[model samples]
Target: MQQGSLARYKLYPSSLLWLDSLSQAGKDLRARCCQIQACDTDMVKGLAADAHRLLARGDASGGAIVLICLADRCRDAGELVLAREYCEEAVSHFSCYDDCRHAHNLAVTYYALGLVYQSLGLETDAIGSYDRALEAFDEARSQWMWAHECAKRMMNECDEVVRWIRELRQGLALGQPAPPLLTGTLVKIPMWSTSAGSLLRVREEPVDWVDVEVSALGLANFALLINGNSMVGLGVQNGDVVLVQETADWPADGQIVVVRMDRMESESVLKRFYRRQDHICLEPANERYPFLIVLPNWRLKEEVSRRYAQSHPERGLEFFLESSVHCVGWYCGKVG
Candidate 1:
């Protein structure tokens, strides 16, 4: 298309071709989409040191779309605030076009905003935003079915959130924290030495509950119990203890890890990490599990290491004892 004709469509200003049908134009758009995906992948892998770069090449509308995409990426990457900001930007993008497209975008944006608000502890505002998003979706009729469907899902989520909010409110009114149902020692305790002697109890209290400080072990602040022998060589076996850390930071190279997959209640054994300048490689001790590399610098390795060292002086030996230390933390034998 001619330069003057291109402006007539008012499509993305940066995109030379406005139509999506042309093969070359499709290729260009796909390429731009790929660029957005690449940036999102980096954000997901926690290498998003400069988020602005993701929007630099795109036009205003393109930037808004990219930001929305990046918000999803950030959510997956565990960067909640950044994700929220991106969603907000997407909402701000269609201020002039307050038609169906605007309503659809606002619905999606507000849904995302609600999620971020809920995560950030703004429950009331989250619910309100979710309600507004639902209303926006209702108003965006006959515009975009996909966006409408997304709004429907968000509306359903509101029901769940409302239940949670009500439960929380009841707790607050009662001046008590919501009681955990399965209360007796929700954590796994590992024995000090694996010599088959009487297991040592790390906690001196009457042991009604086992509290493990997971973050102190160079892992995320969470723990999981391994129910299989898939991770045997790494001292994790069936019924063995596994600890997981969940933070925005990525794992270092060749460190043992626990990853909660797409559909599993228990987080499975991820592999030891292998660090690189650009990415961190996960290598499972058992060859059955394939190794994969993710963008590096997801986790604060040095900080985790220093914290782990301060917490467990004896366990620090593993760093020097093994060719590579993938995991650092105290593990105890799991008992009823």
Candidate 2:
């Protein structure tokens, strides 16, 4: 929180100092909290009582500050939900304070909220919190570039390197020379299979997929595209091109699969396939959608049935190319 607030109050050294002092004191609350269960569970109780008294004395800011301390204590003890509730209450109580009227503080509150959201794998909310934090930094005209810099850094670390590779392979398969990049144009690469006697190709205006250079060492190149809001818990989202390769046949449960669902249809959705006794089920990453179940006696093709007969299949699906799937890894760019 202090780090987040610092970006919004570069000019107000004295105010920053005071806030930092309070933040440090909040840390002290943690030490006292450890003593509470043994010596006095009443320590936090006493603090809350004192905070209420402060509130009655027209010191709402002080009271809120104390609440923040208690909330941090809860967070330290891994009681995140409780911590978040108390932090929110603290922010609400101090929001109207004259001395605490600052964008930096507001940003800190949002950042703290973002932490809560992130802990629960609420990617959409976490992104919003980061955005609000940046807004607060902008409002204060802060000189600190940490927030923006962090954004840039994340992009650098986790950009769609795989998508670029997939586009390149797709172009090669289509008997077309690769362009500079495949991102600008959105082309749906058709799923093809000789074994299934399926040949589906729905081509549109070609996209110039980006070219990402892989490391010189043993890391093989791969690519995939992200679609839908599923996999948000894993920080992978729709429209992100992912890069992956064929490993061993053994994949633990909950492994994602870029499967060819419909051999007859021109397109197929990437689904996470879970194998159960006498059943092959397709699960989506997003909980909003229902999982698809295929019973053993279900009327799926006989050829595919025997192909997936084993409890643990000898080989997971293999891709002809290295970059076979793509996903927008998290941060769907929606704010609500």
Best by lDDT: 1
lDDT measured at residue 122 in model 2 versus the true structure, 0 to 100: 59
What C-alpha lDDT do the candidate models reach, one value each?
0.41, 0.40
Total clashes for model 1:
22
- lDDT digits (tens) for residues 189-281 of candidate 1: 332211111112222222222343211121122334444454567566655444332322333333344432222222133455556454444
TM-score of each: 0.32, 0.31
Please give the lDDT score for candidate 2.
0.40
Candidate 2, 1-336: lDDT as tens digits: 222221222111111212332432332332232223211225656766666676677665556666554544444344567657756766576456433234445545554555455555555665665566555444433323244634443232112222332343344446555342111222222111111111222223223233332111001122344446655555556655543322222123444544432332433344555566555555555555444445444354454446544542543322211123222111111111
Candidate 1, poorest ten consecutive residues by summed lDDT? 9-18
lDDT score, residue 24, model 1?
31
Assess candidate 2 and give its TM-score to the true structure.
0.31
Question: Alpha-carbon error at 273 in model 2, in Å?
Answer: 65
